[model samples]
Target: YDSCVNSVSDPSIFVIFEKHQVYPEYLIQYTTSSKPSVTPSILLALGSLFSSRQ
Candidate 1:
């Protein structure tokens, strides 16, 4: 997959990590438990981690 990553056109998929996180599972459950579509707000909440200075 690493060799093909450069050929891929999708900007959303970059890399896959082996580390697991309960928070990510929680986010998926919360988003999919009720509705099929994942809310943008929930995505923003998850993405906020990268924006933090600390």
Candidate 2:
């Protein structure tokens, strides 16, 4: 996928975004029991790591 990011929502996702130097709007909140993840947890993680520092 061109311009698409592979997300994992397990803090590991940050590696991809950080490496690419851009943030994906969505994140998959993968959990120890969740199936096909999605929701606020992932979003918060993304924001925590990728959002503008200023």
Highest TM-score scorer: 1
**Decoy 1 TM-score against native:** 0.27
lDDT of 1 at 17: 44
Error of 1 at 52 (Å): 2.0
TM-score of each: 0.27, 0.25
Lowest-sum lDDT 10-residue window in model 2: 8-17
lDDT of 1 by residue, 11-54 (tens): 54445444342124343333336547889998999789778957
User: Can you give the lDDT of residue 38 in candidate 2?
Assistant: 79
State each model's CA lDDT, in order: 0.55, 0.61
Candidate 2 stretches with Cα past 4 Å from truth are 1-35, 52-54
